[model samples]
Target: MRPQDSPTRETKRLDGRWHFLADPAGAGRAERWFATPLQARDGVEEMPVPASYNDLTTRPDLRDHIGEVWYQREVRIPRGWAGERILLRLESATHRATVWVGETELGSHEGGYLPFDVDLTDHARAGELVRVSVAVDNRLTWQSIPPGVVEDTDAGPRQRYWHDFFNYAGLHRSVWLHSLPQTRIEDITVLPDLDGDTGLVDYAVEHSGQGSVSVQVLDASGAVVASDDGAAGVIRIAGVHPWEVGEGYQYTLRVTLSSDGEVADVYDQRFGVRTVAIEGAQILLNGEPVYLTGFGMHEDHVARGKGYDDASWKLDFELLDWIGANSLRTSHYPYAEDVMDYADAHGILVIDEAPAVGLNMAIGGGIFGGQGYTTFSPDTANEATRANHAQVLTELYQRDKNRPSVIVWSIANEPESDTDASYDYFAPLFAHMRSLDSRRPVGYVNVMLSPYGKDKLAGLCDLYMLNRYYGWYVDSGDLDNAMLHLRDELGQWAQDGKPILMTEYGADTLAGLHSLDGATWSEEYQQDLLEATHAVFDEVEEFVGEHIWNFADFQTTKGIMRVDGNKKGVFTRDRRPKAAAHRVRERWTRIRGRA
Candidate 1:
């Protein structure tokens, strides 16, 4: 859970080819597939772990399969891990997963984007072959977090959801086999604050066995700047360098657990000395007003389909730097931990969001569909959905609480916040988020349908995050009316006296498509829409940020509204720059220079 490694810890990546089988009839569990080798079963194929099975296969049946799938692989325990506590860790396992070692069930987990580990110390011996089987289910119901429904069609089962993106699911992250000491550190929390010229780091350590904990704060040069001896205490450093926007200054906090005068475990955590506060109509980072300029991104690419690719990940940050942007929101779900590390090292701000999208049933047809039904009914997104949402928020906070780049915790994206039922649903969730971590601002992305007068949950939020599609979804190719409507909405929201961030605003632009005049779906149109939106953003004094709708084109559910996929990206899906990318770069560069 804590970045996976330290001096007393070791990890091995179980991320190669594995035997896979799709159980569209839901017969895996009844057939006892986990008890024997998957090769003995029919229709089994070799598939790559840490990648979605949907896009990897050539068969359409496997691509759109709607039920449980099984993955089996053999792992050998290292001889050096004889006396250590060995564990099997999955970085992510789609919507839900159940694990099995040999014939015994290890455990089960529900959330898709977070990590979970199963202890294998008592099951396997050193230097022995162990068979690991995992069954992953991609179905989503009213009780699920990002709720959806599966309908049986004439051909097969069809998966339907309210969100605009494709539901590509599998083991979309790495699988790890790690070893830890018998008496080791379980969790470490580092909360850094600033007082004048001094840096105060409040720390806490949770260990498994009895031990004496000591902490040392090391600077960038690996020199000890402060030291403390306790399970929980504060360490002060004089003349501290604050971690600023576009300038990442990190200090390492090394924690050591000693028992019987011998070293039990050593873990080092990286932290930045900074604080986030909301004052009047400004969101301040370390007491300075910081504007967010980036995109609402997804962990999606060609072939991988929500799977984590290191090359694509690195190129994304490189492109963000090229565009002179400062921040981004993990739009719908929590991203991989390594991505957070990259943002932390590069000084890019993050709006950490939960996987609470598509809570409204009125727009199940799409964002531009009808809106009559209530969003929070017993058969739809009801109390069960709220419980799952709360669990994800807790997991998200526990994972990324110490990171300095996380400035805001977005609860949901574009829910039906105008309805009275929505108010009852989201109000407690916002309060729950605050109870988890009050240091950062907590709010949800408001849909265009939920205007200032109709919205009820706005009063509960610390700040406002609006996803307005003025020229695209609302006004439709009329820039003049779109800008007018955008300004009017901002004027109404500005009256609330809270910092407002435009979390989404852009047009779908096909690459190389041009017109003499700005036409819809043309590259010129995308550029003009962004520039016009920026003009409006500058007019609103409460506007603190503007992250475009998407960073790149990504696949979505098949429909008449999509051409291949969403083309709102400033760049193509393969990472090619469009005309809008250059325009954004020019504007953000000036903004960064001014700051």
Candidate 2:
């Protein structure tokens, strides 16, 4: 079916500012930094919005790094913008940030990989220049993990098992100012069901002024399959085919608003129909078992650093398919909507992560599993931890629920959340997710050893996944040994029997980079590793799925081999193919036909 185009963005803009290193000492130092009166008379320097500190600063010879940066920009609403809902929308800033408009405080937002906004409608005056100041803090504190924290059992920090990806910060996404009439569409949701060949949607429109709202669904032929009068607050769409990974069913959504019986606003979004589940152990895509050759991915390009461009996703996906991967993990954070939609339409599965990474490492002297790390289980969690957990989970679920490629709402990958209560923390959130949409699975990579551990959480999950690094962490390169380890572990679970999925595996590679001994982070090493891992799969009937550690090389703060991130990607960051990429592609694409 033909899909409708998304709404054209607001043409109005206020951008360009100078960034500085922000510290307590600089607190009151930059009032003029955001002073619009100063800017109008040519006070502050000009820099683009949704930019990085490294990109706009004097730090030229750069390495893997994150720190505090200050941004000051000025904007003035013309008297014409009176009564309009004006918002300061920042797609993301690295780490945590606080928004201050002049001396008045606006709001504080956390997570560097998602979009957030603050209402600045009443904060600014007509023809009055308002200063916008931001403190982008990627600093390390008890509650934060700087880009480079990993654990090594041997001695000083050297080796550990963290999903290898770059930790690029700063405002890495688009920033815009939106002006709308009092009544407006606040949020839109669409859920696709391929088996039933139907789609469901719930659009929440909030308004300060009363108006008429309506929703319409159009198919490929530009014919409307559905149109219904919508409440000013909420509207729902039913019996529509949801988006699918490969079948290519689509529909366009057109929401219209009217005041005094005349149209005031319209918004459009195009989407497809698909469903995902963990039926027993294997991942079910549109009701069919899908064994995944998945790759964990990052957004930063090698040269571009924290900056982003649209073309790279296509190149990235091309290399991924060439390597035979069926899934991609936008590791440690949520990705842009375009990238998310592209994956869904092109037959790739996604594990859309929240922007909370290495939270445990920041809390308990730097580690992946600890008792107080995560409040995934809300029942017994401390108020603060649970609050953060609830915040991240809620925002992630609400933002990305429409995409068909998303299968898992991962809470924390390596959070050392060791407690029987950990499961309780997750139970409510997982239940909440099911209440929202019952077709997807919700789980995290195993980290803590709680009373509920693997034994209990296994059954709680529709699909069980592990971030096991036997070869790198345990030094067991033997397949026979690895298989025995996997079997013995699941043999215990065969009693209550939950199907297993290897969400993470594989070693770090330096691509064509070789050692003095002439062996690079070689294909031979990865081949031996995959061979043993496959042996486990061959022997363990309960083991039904696999997603290797990463898709491409990314930036990071920890050391893998002289690099902070594990170069373990089957391909390099620049899209160069490593030997393992071909090997895995042959394994998954043996039966090949494309839409």
Candidate 3:
């Protein structure tokens, strides 16, 4: 599993310019673009693959578009892949996606954060030119996970969600055409545990056709440390070295599928032998207590929007290393899978989250209005939304269950958990998540409502992950009041007898603005707010962690309240440190020394 080693299966990349057309009126279906030849189409524009169509151009209309968008590309199948099973895999397409090859319909997927595949073996032929059409709908409805309403405004229709980030949509990740044998390895699940220095790995291999599976666990030096000859079983390696923060140790599990003595497919699943546990209000890693420190980040940037940017992430890691941070919460949603892999390789702790943001009915009315609003329930009783939420959680679990970097699973972010209906909605989800993976602690990023009101659903989580904007959102510019409020809330939460992580707390600072009196949108105000919160943290014994509100500035729906997106990042959108960054670096460095 080195970068230089080629994959056993052949893959053709389809990640360049594709013919794009905005279908606000839903005319693409009436016109039958899937059945029509590309050459005969009109009004088609070229847009890059793996990019958010919102940020790809200078057109304001396209940037704020909220409807179905059509993308078409022509690809030729390799002759060698004729007899093999062909599949079109998209790393992600926002909201919903319908795919088609020529006149044949391939299937559609609902969720946007996880990968989806369409089997093309029956619809496509080798060495032939095939037209692939993808229809992506970015509109949000009340039934969506991040529930919102489409309202008719002066500017046609506006798409708004309860979340505080821009709804950037398109093919935000890579797409590829993979060719595999008919009897190929579908998936591999590796659950690693530790018995002192020895590593016990419980594994299961899934396949398409009947086969005998053999697994080999290779150590860091490419030495075979353990082996098994069944599709489902466990293997143990003596003298195993556990993975630690900033140490980045990994082992490769090579799963070989053979049908009647003929090699069918070989797959590699990399994992780290580590254990995460919560023992009596302490978060333990490898049986040792560890405190979390980092930011709740987004997959966002100025030019790329929500599209996955490798350079941004590399710079982000460098910044995190400089800030002496060891962990981060994938705030509000699950990031790209490559991010999880990078965290595993670099030894950063992750709180893997789902795209379950905006499950609230109270917010989303332009910032100034939604303040103090009540009844923000995300209709957990709706059977369809609940079913979809469960499926999304299942997919998120299956995708990242083996990554050692992921120690916790965040089921939701700031949902309507203060009401009785909230309990009905979250209890089933909490149970489903627990049943899916028992290795990680499952919780939601509770909002300020949990502390201010009755947290009827707080018992659903193993840990209390709270998000509060006391000074900025409530008593503005009053650090004294903020400290008093934070102390009272933290004291209240500690009484629950659970490890508490102050998952989010920060002020929106316009990068360089200064204020002698500590007013809002000033660097001084942001610094003071955080310092006050940290001061309270020192007094609270149960405060296990504090992740800043944002890793960097990110886009959001246009509003007078947001000065060109949310500007709460310690770092600017260009990945440059603001004044608050220096204070954070200093505080974190001192904390790291004590740690």
Candidate 4:
């Protein structure tokens, strides 16, 4: 079944050319760029609105830009939309964003991986051209999630981060000016479950103005199946067709807000009826245990550089399908809503992750060897950063909670979970995530840390998601030694009596390189390492899944260790497969229906 677009009342696409200016000195606020028309300003240049400024030019300086950049554009609100509640919606902004409509300051939002909106109802009159200015800052500091340092160099203050990826900053997603009724539905939440033979849908809706609400649940044929009149209630169908893996079935939910028998607003949402549970060291999907076999992917490419592209989107799914993959973890952050929609329709499982990468306290260390033995402390685990981390998790959950494709939520990527501060910081955060959606399992991706007393927060996770690079990082090129260490570690973790997923394990090999001796950086070496890793995984019944480190190569912060970029990808950056791809396909295909 093809996925349908989200229903909306009225919308005007706000993409295309916009005036841009780099503000390295943070002079935008001082100069009051938000208070005046940007066209009158001198140093403004034309730039595409829904793109990263770093890759739009060939200049190396622009590609490595740090600090704030202003983007201003002229928009005309529809004349007929005067009585409607106008909203200026930005799909995503990098790091931090402040929006101004005309001279009125709408407000600011922190964090960049989620959407933000500004109500432009009182700021602009309909049928008039309004100046909209947005200030985006991509700088990172110790006080920020994914903490870093700003060093003053001879040229200027250089922005640096603890994360591996390049800071591709700007408005990296689409923007829109949409309209809705004043007495509109604020939010709609749907939690689907199986109640014996009946399909149960529990929902809660929030609205702004006083109005009587009627909710209707429609099946695939667009016929109303169940309904109720109120703000929140459950609607159950007599016999519900369950959404299964590799086979998708979805239902439409329409909520209408009305006063005096006239409909004031309508919100249309789509969801699937399914249940995800953990049954004694096994992950059960729709009451059947599933073995996850796929890769941890990134929203990355060569030219786009994290900017969303339709062609890449289509190609990605095609390749995944070709390689016989059933699932993938949205490795480091929540992906675009459309990506989730695609997965929901295609029946691909997802492990939604938060943008809490680089939370580890060890800033600089040896590339392969462990960092100079540091632990999480109050300096890196302060209240402000933790609060931001919590907020990002909330936004991520709220934005993607409806998608049935997402079976698990990964809170952080590679945080320092082996310390007392880590336990203190993640205890409340993990509780919050589980509270938001109890239907799905929640966990964090643990790095190369000892679970024997060192990993204090292992109990907090429903599943242990380990990212181990034994042959690649620890033992260098010796798979026998790597497998020996892996077996001992797995044996230790199995004592906890919980399911585990090798969330990341792969050797970085440049495409087309071959060596019969199986040396590092060769395709044969990568395949051999994966074969050894799988052998250990096969021996342990507690091991449920394994997602190779990366689906493809992606750009990273400049480092001597990287050859242009990280080459751990089973497929090259261009989506072409290496020798490991054929091996993975054969393995996944053989165990497709083991349950």
* lDDT values for all models: 0.90, 0.59, 0.84, 0.83
User: Ten consecutive residues with minimal summed lDDT in candidate 2?
Assistant: 1-10
Measured with C-alpha atoms, the lDDT of residue 286 in candidate 4 is: 82
Estimated TM-score for each candidate: 0.98, 0.80, 0.95, 0.95
Q: How many residue pairs clash in each candidate?
A: 0, 35, 2, 0
Model with the higher lDDT, candidate 1 or 2 = 1
Output the TM-score of candidate 3. 0.95
**Predicted structure 4, TM vs. truth:** 0.95
lDDT winner between candidates 3 and 4? 3
- Where in model 4 is the C-alpha error above 4 Å? 1-8, 36-43, 363-378, 593-595
Tens digit per residue, CA lDDT, model 4, 1-595 = 1111233368888888898988866788888988887767777788886677887787787788788899998899999788888888887788889999877789899887788888899988889899999999888766566566677899877875666677778887788888887787888898999988798999888888889989998988999999988898888977897777777688888888897678888878889999999888999988889998888998887766777777898898988877777899987877877788889988899999988887775533215334433335555447788888889888888888888899999999878887777898889999999889888999998888555457988889899899898898889898999999999898888888889999999988999888989989999999999999999999998999989988998888788888888899988999999999988888887878431
Model 3's lDDT to the true fold?
A: 0.84
lDDT of 3 at 395: 88
In candidate 3 the C-alpha lDDT for residue 294 amounts to 95
Q: List the residue pairs that clash in candidate 1.
A: none
Model 1, which residues run further than 4 Å from truth? 371-374
lDDT of 3 by residue, 2-107 (tens): 1111244788878888889888778888788888754466667888877888987888888888888988888999998878888898888888899999988899
lDDT winner:
1
Better of 1 and 4 by TM-score: 1
Candidate 4 residue 492 C-alpha distance from true site, Å: 1.1
